[model samples]
Target: MQQIIAAAIQFNVQQGDVEANLSHVRDALARVADRGAQLAVLPELWSTGFAYRTLTELAQRTDAVVAELQELSVRHNLVIVGSQPEPAGDNRVFNTIHVIDRGRIAATYRKLHLFSLLGEDTAFKGGERWCLAETSLGKIGVIICYDLRFPELSRRLALEGADLICVPAQWPKPRQEHWRTLLRARAIENQLPVVAANACGLIGKLDFFGMSMVIDHCGEVLADAGERPGEVLATLDRQAMTAWRAQIPCFADRRPDLY
Candidate 1:
């Protein structure tokens, strides 16, 4: 069985505090590493904790976050996925996820779908492209919080040969059901595993519910954090997924001609 231990680091993000938030994430990564996780995922806007007022102020240069992640990846010997506020070169800021594998950046995906209710469209620039990165485990696709609502994005990544999709989010309590349902739906419909890392506690006026989870291709919940700040670990079986895909033959049965 080709297996890898994946972890979702669910934590309470401190608003407007990059240094403290990074420190917290570092600790979380260390904890997951100690527990034998080959891949550790963090929540969206983790560095700044969804601070809308000072998003630009808290935005870090991509190089800075990447450098820190590189060091952490090498130290822990694990892959890391997370997002931060990034400058877009024209005074625009983007919510971007950087995939670091064994001390090197494998890929970066900026959030394509921004939440209008949270004023994300007004505050941050939406990404224009989708990305998938090949890793030691398998081909992995990345998307931010609101991007999970769009099945088209995940479907595109699945068609591009992504075996797993990682979602880092700061989803609030009011929409917790949406988060859980979407995660499972994406996994079942795409016939691939989905790892979601979400923030907990309060960020400004909004309260975040931390039900971070790892769902397999059949929509089974391998692990869940359950409304608390902690790490949820699960082992992914690539061989089993491959066999299941062969048996179901969903990908091979796709007919794009009519669509």
Candidate 2:
């Protein structure tokens, strides 16, 4: 990993309106690329924002949506990461993140943790394994919205030598502090940069407060898109992160056996 400008593209996703959402994404990504962003992260369920009743039907169009993303990635010369619904057998779907690296799919990560508070466990299936996208830029560990609460998952990614953590989320209100704090905590503990994109505006009866962020290894907020539909940009410096890790020496001092 070297110095790279990363972007978190936060926007309001019209429920079940895949075309509208895709149009917005296409324009946002074009601007992000124009701003010299090598990597762009979009919110979870970006194509269709948890339209539970029609998820399976909506998932049928994922392949086409991904093809569009590939075109954008190649045209802009950027890496894109975001989650979408994947059709599973028996009328269920999997919340999967597609890591597209300049027109090629670098990795596909099925979200491991399902948010039961919203009845996600009943509606969708969780993945058995985690994902680490090894792209030309770096090794990026991908995780979805609710997965941020589980420190063990991020620690596992750190152990796998991930250079950065990419989070695509639809984090809502009444727990904005939790979203902000946990993102930084993951970066601080793992000694890796974090680029997280979250949605903004009201959807259904829920209010989504977008606080898309980019954090450094020491947990410093490099960029923040506070409660709005916009993109946050930050330069992730690998040399600085490495120097910070060496100064702190936290990863080297872990004592896992005693526990």
lDDT of each: 0.89, 0.94
Candidate 2 overall lDDT versus native: 0.94
Q: What's the lDDT for residue 146 in model 2?
A: 96
Candidate 1's clash total is: 0
lDDT (Cα, 0-100) at 3 in candidate 1: 86
lDDT of 1 by residue, 1-259 (tens): 2888999998889988877888888898999999999999899988887677777766754468679889999999998999998887665699988899998789989999988986788888999999998887778999998899999999999999997999999999888899999999999889999999999998888899999999888899999999888999999888889899999998889888978
Candidate 2's displacement at residue 203, Å, is: 0.7
Error of 2 at 234 (Å): 0.6
Q: What's the TM for model 2?
A: 0.99
Best by lDDT: 2
What's the true lDDT of residue 228 in model 2? 80
| lDDT tens digits by residue: candidate 2, 1-259 | 5798999999998999999999999999999999999999999999999999999999999999999999999999999999999998878899999999999999999999999989999889999898998998999999999999999999999999899999999999989999999999999989999999999999888899999999998899999999989998999999998898889999889999986
